[model samples]
Target: MFREVPVLPVVVPVAAAVFLILLWYLHSRDRLSAPRAAVALALCVYAAGVVANTVFPIFLDKPARSALWKVYLVPFANYEVGDAVTNILVFVPIGVLVPLLVAKAPWWRVVAVAAAFSLVIELTQLVTRNLLGGGHVADVNDLIFNTAGGALGFGLCSALSRVPAAAALIDRFRWR
Candidate 1:
């Protein structure tokens, strides 16, 4: 049975508020240009979407199962290739955005951050699944694939930066 969980209804407004605050603070500091503002907005929207997808549908009624094996440890042991691909794709924007936001974001740093983010998502899922309601069980494969996605995104960003013309364009959007 599916229970409606009102996640976005709360998430969207909070994200918008944070975005507005960030825009205001940046503008006040004379750092908010059109490009930076666009990036900030996009980041906020993406973050909200991530939270919605990763941590919601928390059915307050009850959990579907009480099994202790929610944390899936084996990689590619029971998942399709498509699931792996999708996980990678989901994190690509993070890989691209971090370097744009930070002046000297290395590929390794991007991968590390992505892995940490994935870990947080999994932990949240594990906790909520056990306590408050519906959440995806933790999975080691997700962590591995999400980090790979971050690396791929950083590689794409690096390639674009190598192009003189594209580099010039991207420079305008660079935060630092």
Candidate 2:
């Protein structure tokens, strides 16, 4: 009964969007709300997935190690550290855009939204690994760091969203 989970983090959000769209199409009288929700949910999921994927491996007791050591090659590079750092750097955008993209998100509400997004990702990882025969172990650190990142991103977006220069820049970019 072990199902396989895809390695790519984006799959969860993409799948969610598809699922939401299908559900809305089948049951909803209002067509617009479904698509709107689908986009919002997908973005939230994507942001969470990015955070979870990046931060979880950092706190493992038996961290993912250098393959070179096993292969009898150079043993200096710690692969796990590299991977963790890369994950943090990679998810920086998720932290920023998810908040701004969210409609009418008040400053106080952003934290809750970020936390909710992080929770979904962590839970998904835990459930997927446990029920799907994957070796992944969910860690609490991932939840914390990911949520922090998302919160930071949200704050940055909120600050910039109000600035006239940033708005002008965005408009210029969108025009091109």
Best by TM-score: 1
- Tell me the tens digit of each residue's lDDT in model 2 across 3-92: 333345545666567657644643564434444455446555664566445333322233334332222123223336554454345445
Task: Give the range of the ten consecutive residues with the poorest summed lDDT in model 1.
Answer: 60-69
Q: List ranges where model 1 is wrong by over 4 Å.
A: 1-4, 63-65
Tell me the lDDT of candidate 2. Answer: 0.50
Question: So what's the TM-score on candidate 2?
Answer: 0.50
Off by over 4 Å in 2: 1-91, 169-176
Give the Cα lDDT of each candidate. Answer: 0.87, 0.50
TM per model? 0.92, 0.50
Candidate 1 residue lDDT tens string, 1-176: 65667997889999999899978977888889999898899889988998899888788677556767478998878987998999999999999999988879988899998999999999988887887666687899999998899899999999999999999999988888
